[model samples]
Target: MYEVVLVDDDVIVTQFLKRYIPWEEHGFKVVASFQDSHSALEYLLENTYDVLVTDIGMPKLNGIELIEQLKKSKSNSYHIILSCHDEFRYAQQAFKLEVFDYILKETMEETNIIALLGRLKEKLDQEQFTRNQHLKVTKFLERNNMTLKSKFIEKLMKEQNITKDGWWKEQEELLKLNFSDKYFTPILCFIDRYQEAINHYENETSLQFSINNLLEEIFTAKDQQDVQIFFTQGKFLILLPMKYNTREKTKHQIEAILKELHETIYAGFEVSITSVIGELNVKEQSLLESMRILLKNKEQRFYYKYNSIQNFYPISYTRDSIFQDYVEISQTIKELILKDKKDQILECISQQLKQIREKKYSPDSIKDWAIKLIIDIKLSLHALNHFERQSVVITIADQVIQYVETFEHLEYVLADICEKFLEQIRSTNLTTRNEDILKAQKFVQTHIGAKISLKDVAAHLHLNSSYFSRMYKKETGEGFVEYVTKTKMTKAIELLEHSTKSIEQIAFELGFENKSYFSKTFKKYFGMTPGDYKYKTKEKMN
Candidate 1:
């Protein structure tokens, strides 16, 4: 809808126009009205309106003077004049000032005014459509230009050699770059905490667009042809030309710009950036080399503190592999899981991730280690009969490595995996303990003829001794050692009653060391030694 403002000395006329114009039906809105032209001009100066309707004969300032002032300031409002027959000359002056139309107050009618507004709405609508089309075309061209530049830069980076004379000149002209023989410094940027940043946006494309807009605005503000920026392959490349004669001075210039860029991006968007600033005096022919060097050093971002801009340094990697202690680490994790040490499990994962970060291993090597570790953990669960293999979990384990862009992110992924694994272990451990207890009872009965130990029972169950001890005591109302002792005593009684085995022989068969210890234990449970019980039973039978 087009906004309309009215200015007329006649209060009645202004009120009537505002109240009964049916402006919405005609695609117009009367936003403000003033009985004096001066007040209307003041409002117009601060706000934008599409149409102005004012009376020519007013007090402090007339409609003609108001239009004249607005014209001087290049306001784009369409002006309509309100005049009586005595003010015909004023209307003439309004036409000279390029007003849209004139209305005589003596002959003005509601229908005529509404019809006029309809035409004005048509004109405004057409102009707005044209402006929108032009804007679309401009954006399309800009996007195409940026795409071409990005492709050209990518091609240069891929080719083994980049010559100054061959395809360089053609691309320079075609892409409208001025780096023929100029000295430039290259800078590369990686979005830190990219996973978090991506989640903050609607999608990846929106995030890219926002960053591009911010970069363009900042670089374009410098208004220098020497500065160029490109977004390609999940990174930003900035080419800063050597404007100063000395490298030190150029360095200072680059520093100032980077400081601004980093601070603004982080402050405005809550997004941290890691930048690698290159040499200040790289020639056009060495541009790709400088860029490649910067790109290679981008791996340094894996260890970079968030929101930092650092000068170029040689890339380094630790010679030792993270998998050297895989056996020890994996075993420790399994023990902790069975022990139900949740905090220790997470801390253990954190420690390994910290080591990997400190070593600054190649990204691929780190990811490989992470994948192997997680998969081995799942396999350990399966071996313990605590986990059933799920294709979904395996798929996650395989694809998770690709998303490990930083040490922090990698740690988060590994930590989440550990937590979920702990959940599975906890849930399954409850049911597993019931089955394990039953199996343990059966094993003890089968092995009751010999001496049974808690350690032996735990080993049979493939569980840690201390963990098994606690679980056995909790599941049953007796300690494992106590249970073993009771089982032996009960068997001794059965032998005494059912068979004519000698006391010494029965003691020996029940895994007792001798008759004295057997008798002592038997007296404690039945209030008599084995000989007394046997004699009493025989007396009762006779």
Candidate 2:
């Protein structure tokens, strides 16, 4: 509702206007009515009103004086002058003050006043709508400007060489960048626990937006000209103008700002960041080099404790291979996995990871060790008839390990893989208890004298060849080929111990085409050639 005030130095006129105008019906509220212009002006000066109706021929301060005083005070109220026939000259003065309309006291009508109020309400509504639209446009332009600045900075960081040509100058002016030849400090920020943070944010853009907003709020001080640029891979760069002349002071300043930033982000977003502040340098080229240094030193973050702030330092690659202990680590983990000691396996993994972390091994080396270890464990367990050969974890181990950015995250990923391994182990154990698996094993033992195939056994059981093969592996944890090979080897041992058959005859009977191939298979399975095994047996007998 538009509030209104009536100021006439006649009690009858003020009473009639207040009681008969139907102010509420016309969306106007007569908040004040005065028989003295001075008191009305005092009330108007202290309070707020949207419309003013006042008599011009009063003593001391008339309606003209009140309107003039309001105009001088920059009041936006719409004014309607109440005048008599002799006060026509006062209407001219009211017009100069931009009064909405004039009303003659002798000929005032309720319909005319209501109509004027309606028009005034429309004007106010239109102005409000225009103001809202202007505000929205302003906000949109500001947001767009920030986006353009971020994109420009991102491009500048990626460019190998920056030329100070016409286009560069144009962009500098457009983006309000003052880094022509001024020395500035570059700092790199890494979002720690990025994999988990990404899951929290649901995507990269949201996480970037949130961090950028926080940076803006923290760096918007008048004394600071620090520009934050979001680089790829959960990394952001800060270009701080040289406020302090010496390198030490500038470094100290950058460190303090980063500490605040780290605390602020963690407090607001529940996320931590690792910051690497580069040395002070001059110009865009220097900045480009500085950025490269910051990014190069980002590798050092892999070994950093979570949410650490550090001066830039190059990463030193170790000459010792992380894989030198590969055999020991792999064998230990494989044994734990086979034993289905999930907690022990995880603890063993944690101990080894801690050792790797303490060594400060390069990220690539750690990843290489992890990938090879996971694959080797899968293969070895499969050979032991404890896991499937083509498991999902085996297929994606390289990709998963290579993408791990931090040792903490790497540990989580390794634990997940181990959990899957235990799942496979438990699955295999459950399958060995399956009645169908036992029946399949019986079929294999009963047909041990013949060369058996997965399809042949699958057909005898009236199951799909492909489906049976899959179910068999999923249930028993070993492929049909391995099961058959082990069964045949056990049978070969029985025949050699009990019957007087030559190794070649036993090999032919067990479906080996050549004695050498059979002996090689026997050596691989039993860790000795058939002749060595038989000779050892005969010597034991003597």
Candidate 3:
């Protein structure tokens, strides 16, 4: 609700206005009423009001003087003037002060005052709505600006050569990026256990956003200049500028910043990041090369722990004799898979990767070998009819190949593929057993009241009775005759419990010709005659 304050030098007028104004009915509440303009000015100094009503003619301070003071203090209240005099000077002064309304005290009416208050309320409401709309538009533009900046940084990084040309200068001005520095250094920052972080956040975009925000805060706090941070393929790339005069000093400063970044991440998010710094002599022409070098240094991360900072060094490769036994390794992997030796298959893949890494083969050669091994395993599964369609295997193989950048990454992919293949084989074995056992179980369950024999079932299945009997026993742990007799006894017990059938009728319903034989079998199974069992059960119920 809007608040209003009334000021008048006449006590009677002030009292009447306070008691009879119906301010609340017009969307306002009279919070204060004063017979002294001085006290009213003092109240206005400390409190805020949505509307102010005061008499124009006063001793020390008039309505015009009070509004002028309010305007000087930047109070945004609507003012209405009340006076007994209809002098031109008073109305002119009120008009000059931007008074919302001028009324003569002798002609004042409650209805007119209420109508004016209503218009003031509408104006306030419109202003509030406009302010809210402006705030929303501002926030939207800020978010869009950030998005566009990120895209521009991504594009700049991907470009092969980035020079300070005309177009580059235009972009620099538009995006507010400062890239005219003499020397540039690239730092590659990778979140440790990135997949676990994703799982914890349950959303990759939110995690990335949080990390970016932290980086931006750190950089801004340190007053780092000519720096750009962007994310690509789950890693952060920061381009830091260095001055020629303080190259060593700048390098040490960057190292300190990286250390702080690592500690802050661990403290805040319980995660560590590994940062690799590239050469500090990178110029505009060599930005792409610097990026490549920094990324290559990220490969060395496999050898170190989290929160390590290191420079790039060439990996020394020595050929191993195991590469000559590629065919034997392939055959061994196939044999292990077929034998369902899960642990041995993983061990073989690990050993092969170790040999390949030691051989220091080119990335292309390693990828080729890995692809071939994946294909051979897939073909073996197909030959055994373990998988119905080849598309699934091909898709997995393509993923492995697509992600094979480093030797360590290749090993991870191959291990994952081996695990998937093991799962497929296990599922296939389970499905085969279910298909056979479920069919037989369904047949027996559906024909429970029929006088079915082993030969009859075998004929229906197109198998010899002897073989079918042995298979059923092996699968269900019961001989064919034993199974059929057990099924009939189970049905006979249900009839005795829930049905009012006579013993002879129950026996006939269960495919038992002789009632005496059925009772004997029931006694053997339950250690009691059917009549005695039923009578005891009824007694317990009573």
Candidate 4:
């Protein structure tokens, strides 16, 4: 139904006109009534009305004059003029202003004016309904555009040398506004324990509703003129202009407010907060730097913090995942052992476990750089083993899973394993069953840097040199000398790549008298000099 505004200086005339119309039956509502034209004009400046009815002969601005003046004000209202004369000239002037109807008070009855209004009211309702439809479509388009803004940001941020003022120049009409500010701000918010949150909510409909409803509330409460929020790469970005208070622009306090808002309102998941403030820089350079600080610092957070969890990328996750993958793969190995699938069971004994070989890693190593080969294998094994096997060997998979949850835990687990195994191997005697092979492996692993030959190894094993060489080749396909060099080179590369020791330092560590000879052997095994190999490998890494 159309909204109606009634204007007349006489209070009785206004009230009589108002009561005479059956507004609901006429498909309109009397939404406003004014005793003076000034109040009606004031209302017109701030509001939209479909129909304006006023008395033509008034003390101040008359109906015909008001209608003519309102045209200059960009008012779209249809006018109905009330007059007291039977003047044809007045009718011509009213018609000149495109007044929908003119009612002469000297001759018109209340029913006659009501009937005229009823016809116009129906047309007004139709126009209002159509106008409402356009508004709905426009709002939908605006929302859709906002959803894509995050994608635009993702691509924009990938550019190397972009500046704050660049996007405005690059495509001025794309956003339909000239940016007057010097720079833009980037904020990254992520759902922490996201997997856990998904698990906590069973159904997709409920989970989606919960996330969307909470985000909706936040956005709806704030002025959305310069704000945007969306998900990318399994995380959310609440990117908007960082508003500085005119009185005192305290960046730290604003950051704290964001943290507190997340904690109070969005308590379902933890958030990580990463923000770059100021128009001094609009590029991701500041975001990149801030992310470095975020990764270096550890903060304890709760559920609501998910919307605030921020980093330059999914890096913290990558570091934490290494240890988690190790534990998961360990669990798979234990499962295969329990199932007694001995054919590929040993093959599954965490073969990729070799990836961590002798490397001293802090909690931050291998972030966002671990190969898909590792992650895919881990995911495949996890999916399969979610309900796969019943283990018999008192599965330490669960224990190891918790321990290997991050690089920090990986180190602890490794040191713990080495410590426990060293004591166990020392106390537990090797049976005569393959005692020779165990002793030989121990010797090869231990004596790689020595100049000992097959004869020396055979003598140490208490076997004749010719017989020992054949047995060693039979037990391991490799001949005696190759085995020693290969083992030595393997350890040498690990030390070179992962440790801080230099080539000369590694020579002493490996018991090699000649560093040059050690270098030669390393080059032979890896197809490059140690220095060149490390350079090429590290360069290729990222």
| Candidates 3 and 4, the one with greater TM-score | 3
**TM-score per candidate:** 0.76, 0.58, 0.47, 0.40
Q: Which scores better on TM-score, 1 or 3? A: 1
lDDT of model number 2: 0.77
User: Model 4: per-residue lDDT, tens digit, 85-174?
Assistant: 668999999999888888887756767977887788677778778999998797666555554654565555455566657563654356
Please tell me which model should have the higher TM-score, number 1 or number 4: 1
lDDT of candidate 1 vs native?
0.77
Number of clashing residue pairs in every model?
A: 0, 0, 0, 13
For all candidates in order, the CA lDDT equals 0.77, 0.77, 0.73, 0.56
TM-score (C-alpha) between model 4 and the true structure: 0.40
* Tens-digit lDDT track of model 2 for 382-408: 544334643444579898887787788
Sorted on TM-score, highest at the top, how do the candidates line up?
1, 2, 3, 4
The global Cα lDDT (0 to 1) of model 4 is 0.56
Off by over 4 Å in 1: 85-88, 195-205, 245-249, 337-340, 384-386, 389-394, 426-455, 458-542
Q: Which ten residues in a row have the lowest lDDT in candidate 2?
A: 383-392
Selected candidate, larger lDDT, 3 vs 4? 3
Model 3 Cα displacement at 134 (Å)? 7.0
Error of 4 at 402 (Å): 16
